[model samples]
Target: MDTITLWELVALAGAATLVGFSKTAVSGANTVSLAIFAAVLPARESTGILLPLLIVGDMFAVRAYRRHADWATLVRLFPAVAAGVVAGTVFMLWADDAAVRTSIGVILLVMASITVWRRRTAGQQAREQKGQGEEEGRGEPAGEGRQRARLKAGSYGVLGGFTTMVANAGGPVMSMYLLSAGFRKLGFLGTSAWFFLIVNVAKVPFSVGLGLIDRHSLLLDAGLALCVVPGAFLGRAVVDRINQRLFERLVIAATVVGGLQLLLR
Candidate 1:
C-alpha cells in the first residue's frame, strides 16, 4: 500500500498525542485517536496501528506514576479481564465491523451510565453517611467498600476486555472504575498504568493472531511512537491540575457521545 497522505500522517500524529494525553489526563478522549485510525486505515488494520501507540502511551503513563499502584486491585481484576478478552476475541472472529462497532458503542453507553449512576449514588451516600454521625471523613461502611470493589473489578474487567479487544477503548472503562474505587491522584495513575501495561502487552499475541499487527503496522507504529513523548510531557503537567471529579464526569459524557457517534455512523 502507498504511504499515508500528508494530511493523514498529520492526523495520525495528532491522534497519537491525544492517546498519550488520554492516558494521563482524560481517558475517554482516546476515542479521537480511534476515529482517526479508522478514518485512515481499514478497521481491522486500525487496531494494529493503534495497539503499539497505546503501548507507547502506557509506558509513559507507567513512568509518570510508577510508584503508586495497588497490587491487590490488579490481582483481583485480572482473571475476569482475561475471560472477557477471550470472549471479545471470539466475538471479533464472528462479528462484522458494523456489528463490532455497535456492540462496543452499546457497551460503552452502558458502562458510562453505570459509572454516572454509581457516582451519584456514592455522593449521596457519602453525604448521608457524613450527616448520620457515623463515619466523619470516611465515606462508606466496610461492607459497602467491599461491595464497591467487587462491582468495580467485575464490571470494569469485562468491559475493559471487550472494548480493548474490539477497538482499544478500554481506557475509559478502567478509568471510571478506578475513579469510583476512590484512589487518589497518584494511586489512580499508577494503578491504571500497571493495569493497562500488563493488559496491552498481553494483547500482542492475540492482536497478531487476528492479523491486527504485522510488519507494516510495526513500521507505522515506530513513526507514531515518537510523538507520544511530547504528549506525555504535556499530559504530566496537566494531570495534577485536573479536577478529578470534573474529569471523570467529562469522561463519562464524552464516552456516551462517542458511543452515539459509533452507533449512528
Candidate 2:
C-alpha cells in the first residue's frame, strides 16, 4: 500500500466512492472506477482490490432495494453466467493484461451499441402501443416477447459473467440487460445489487486461488471502503431525482466512455 503515491490514493478513493454511487444509483458508472483502479494498480491486482469495495457498496444497495429484486430473472441468468465465468477463469490463466483490457473494451463497445439500438426499438414499441390505445401486446406477440426475453437473458448473462470475471466490468452489460427488460429504477437497482453480491462473493475463492486477492489487496480495500459510505448516501439521495430517460442516457454515456478509455489506454 505504501508503494502508491498520494495522488494515486486520492484517485482510488474517488473511484471507490463512485463504486458505491454506481451500485445504488448510476449502475454502470463504476466502469470509471475500474479504469481508475487499473490505472493506479497492476491491472490484475486492481480487480482484486476493487472486488471487496464493490461488495461493500452492493450491501448498501441490497439493503436499500432488496424487496424489488426479480428472482425469476436471476434464475434464468445464473446458468449462462456460470458458464461464462468458467470460460473467463480459463482465459485468465493464459491471457495478459493488454489482452483482457482490449477484449473487455470491445465487448463493452458492442454491448453499448446494442443497448442504444434496443432503446430505439423500445421507444418505437412504446409509440406503437400508444397509437393502439395502450392495448397490451397489440403490436407484438406474447410468445415473441418471451422468446426475445430468453435470448436477452442468455446472451447478456454470458457476457456479464465473462466481463465481470475478467475485469469487474460486468455492470455495464447488466445495466443494458435490465434496461432492455423494462425494469424501472428500483427493480434495476435491486436486481443488480443482489446479482453482483452473489456473483462477487462466488468469485472470492477463485480470486484467492489466482493470487489476485492477498493481504496487500485487503489492506488497500479497507482504506478505499471508507470512501464508499458517503458515495452510497449521495447515490440514494439522487437516484429518485433523476428521471428514467436521463438515467439510462447517463449510464450509456458513461459506459461508452469507459470502454473507449480501456481500449485506448
Off by over 4 Å in 2: 111-115, 118-122, 125-141, 145-148, 243-261
lDDT of 2 by residue, 69-124 (tens): 88888898998899878888888888787887777667667767866786687676
Candidate 2's displacement at residue 100, Å, is: 2.6
Give the alpha-carbon lDDT of every model. Answer: 0.76, 0.80
User: Which has the greatest TM-score?
Assistant: 2
lDDT of 2 at 95: 76
Backbone Cα, N, C clashes tallied per candidate: 0, 0
State the weakest 10-residue window (summed lDDT) of model 2.
133-142
Residue range 209-241, candidate 1, lDDT tens digits: 987789988988888898877888888888768
Q: Of the candidates shown, which would achieve the greatest lDDT relative to the real structure? A: 2
Q: Give each model a TM-score.
A: 0.82, 0.85
